[model samples]
Target: MDLGFGREKRLLTPQQFKAVFDSATHKVSSKHVLLLARDNQLEHPRLGLVIGKKSVKLAVERNRIKRQIRESFRHNQSILTGVDCVIVARRGIADLSNIELRQQFDKMWKRLARQRLAADQANSTGQTNA
Candidate 1:
């Protein structure tokens, strides 16, 4: 229940971000966002955001979108454990309000959790079959 957006919960290095992008096992996408996730072999989830200037245009708007994404991730971190997630902002994301963004993020997080569960089950079942 520690819901703080700590430094440990952020994808800080270029190599870390590249690893998630290059080897993501799960992806969730909407009109305004693309969420790519890979297992990080850690106890907590980490977030990396890519809000390109070409898509968002203004620095203020991009910063606002990042804030919304970080807040949403922080609130849902418990359920998002053991994954490194990268959220790429698409063109229309800047137009949405914080509430709408949060809603979208919530859905994406649920989808990711489901995928993780299914993958775990598959692994367990495969081991049993062997």
Candidate 2:
């Protein structure tokens, strides 16, 4: 992935998302998905993508999605701070190009930022925090 155009703050490890998924609150929808990730607090925001065989039949297709996601994250990971994210693909995602993938990723990132800000505001208010 040629992500040198932007710097990514990544915590690249399986255990990171695993721990968050084990105990985190989450929100999901067709346009975007997210987890209220706080497991890897001391490190920078990180990302993981699950492109299963069921989503993309061929290994090459699956790898392409993974690569696109990695590049997307590398290019935009800074927008997500103090959180861990894992983007699991739906079955229809294989045909998207790198640009399309990035656009989808940007949408997801925007949704995530909205959620994070809401969560922070809720926390500050001691209200119903996700």
Predicted model with the maximum TM-score: 1
Q: For candidate 2, what is the TM-score?
A: 0.75
TM-score of every model? 0.97, 0.75
lDDT of 1 by residue, 1-130 (tens): 8899889999999999999999999999999999999999899999999999989999999999999889889889989999999999999898999899989998899999999999999999999999
Model 2 lDDT per residue over 89-111, tens place: 77678777778877887776677
- The stretch of ten residues in a row with the least summed lDDT in candidate 1 is 68-77
CA lDDT, candidate 2, residue 81? 58
Candidate 2 RMSD computed on C-alpha atoms after optimal superposition onto the true structure = 4.5
Quality of model 2 by C-alpha lDDT: 0.64
Q: Which residue pairs clash in candidate 1?
A: none
Clashes of each: 0, 0
